[model samples]
Target: MCLLAFQLQKHPKYKLIMMANRDEAYNRPTTPADFWSDYPDILAGRDLEQMGTWLGINKQGKIAALTNHRDFSLPETGGQSRGHIVSSYLQSNETPEDFLEQLHNSKNEYSGFNVLVGSSEELYYYSNIEQKTEHLKNGTHGLSNAFMNTPWPKTEAVKKLLCDYAESTNEIDVDVLFNMMQRAERFPSEQLPDTGVGGELESMLSSIFIASKEYGTRCTTVLLVDSEDQVYFEERTFKNGVFATAQKFSFTIENPTA
Candidate 1:
């Protein structure tokens, strides 16, 4: 997940509301969300090349999502795929804090990443670069290539939109939320972050939706789990910046958070 805005335990009817866009290389092999035959409880899109996932929820009500830290100066290879962090956490018996502690101890084995995990009662945030696990507060929060809610222009803009959505009504409108992810505006050069990538490249990635010939926003996802434990997950995939298809799944969660 490249850009996301989520609210945990902030609404009266819904316990978790998350909308994220997964930006990946067009050449990377990927499959839409599903319940793995080997792990029926796990529901998420798969990174076929690496056998991992960017975001998912299980029958146990565990939820997780991952984003890569922006630092082009650092090499992007020779490390484990960060997507595994989400899948492993969702499948494990460990609590969110316990799993993050294990990850913190062996973080160097993976590349730079930001992971969000836990249950409806609480959500945890951890980034290898930040090297600290934080319990996310009960409010709408934004995430991108940097740390959680670091106030990137796009992050701030989308976060505010999410916060307003949560505050405006009890039922979420998936169309409106998904439309917010299609923004392609470039941040003013002065507002852009210098993450060692070239200025031109930075400009292209500055928007909420990233579009390029080689790499772009491959999928846009919206997930909502209500107080009744009903889950709604939808993923709209794209091919080289063009619309492809959407995968929709719904189920009742029975997994225990404790």
Candidate 2:
């Protein structure tokens, strides 16, 4: 998930609310949000290339999402895919804080990325790039390719929407969040990081929404876990060569202990 905005609370009707965008090139192979056959309780869009996911939720009320770290100086070491970190966390039995602590000590196992994990009791964030992991205090937060709460254009856009959505006392629903995500705009190409690998040049040559591309949002995703522990996940894909598409899925805590 490239951009994520959320409201987390302890309320009974809606304990956790999340909206995010999973930006990637159009050609990346992925299975849209659905229940995995091997893990029926796991609901998320799978990255077919690696048995991983940008975001997912399990029937036990666990939630996880990951964002690639934006850095030009790091070497490509063919480390574990960041999506696997999210999927592994969602499939674990650890609490948010415990899971983050474990992840902090095991960062060397995976590529640099930012991860978000949560349950009904807590929410935590981990960034391998920064080598830090901690719980998020009660408040709204936004995260993109950079650090959490960094004011990038997409982050700010989603943050503003989240704040606006939170003010209205009306019952929040998944569709409302999906509409907001769909309407999100991409950042200008010039703002993209210059990887010095002719990324800027390639961006100019092709319209693919590559992270290395000049400026564009490859995907947008939103996740909401209501007070009832009902988790909702949605994503929109943008490809330079084809029409865009959107997908959404929802799952509630079954038995709250699954």
Candidate 3:
């Protein structure tokens, strides 16, 4: 996932509300969100290339999402697939803290990344670049290629959009959340962050929804977990900058606290 904005335990009707966009190359093989035949409990879009996922939530209430840490200064040495970071956590029974602690040792085996893993009741954020695992507080937060809530123009704007929509209504609207993430408005040049990808590319990626000939947002996902343990997931995919198909799933957590 390239961008994420969420409200955790800050809304009256829902325990967790999240919207994310996954930007990738047009040719990367992928499967839309669904329960794996091999692991039926896991619901997520699969990266066919690595046999991993970027975001997922299993029937046991385990949720995980990952984003790459963009730093062109470092050489692109091949390493373990970062997508496995999300899939591994969702497939394991380890608590967020435990999984992160274990991952800390082998972080370098993979490229720099930021991962969020936890259940609807609790969530944590960790980044290999910063080498810190944070027990996320109950509030609205945003994550992108940088550190959590780093106030990059896109991050801040999306965070505010989520915070406003969440605070103003007791009932959550999935379409509204999806619409918020579809914003393709790039920020002003002066307000963009310098990620070493030049001004042109930086401006293009500044928007929540990215569209380019080669690399752009391929899909958008919305996840909502209510106080009653009802889980709702929806993924809308795009084909070469245009909408393609959408998949939706709903299920109640069997043992949310366990």
Best by TM-score: 3
Badly placed stretches (over 4 Å) of model 2 are 10-12, 173-175, 183-219, 234-250
Which digits, one per residue and each the tens of the lDDT, describe model 2 over residues 1-258? 666787777333577777776666656777777789988888888888888998878888777888887665786544777788888887778777777788878788776788988765577888887888778887778887778997666567777877787766557766677666655234576665454446645344222123444334556566666766676667666665233787777677876742
> Which candidate number maximizes lDDT?
3
lDDT of 1 at 78: 34
The C-alpha TM-scores of every prediction are 0.96, 0.80, 0.98
Model 2 score (lDDT): 0.70
Q: How good is model 1 by TM-score?
A: 0.96
Scored by CA lDDT, what does every candidate get? Answer: 0.90, 0.70, 0.92
- TM-score order, best first, reads 3, 1, 2
Instruction: Identify the superior model by lDDT, candidate 1 or candidate 2.
Output: 1
Clashes per candidate, residues 3 or more apart or on different chains = 2, 12, 0
Over 124-224, each residue of candidate 1 has an lDDT whose tens digit, in order, gives 99999889999988888999999999989999999998888789897898999899999988999899889998899989999999899899999999998
How many clashes (backbone atoms < 3 Å, residues ≥3 apart in a chain or on different chains) does model 3 have? 0
lDDT sort, best first: 3, 1, 2
Question: Could you tell me how far off, in angstroms, the CA of residue 63 lies in candidate 3 after the best superposition?
Answer: 0.3
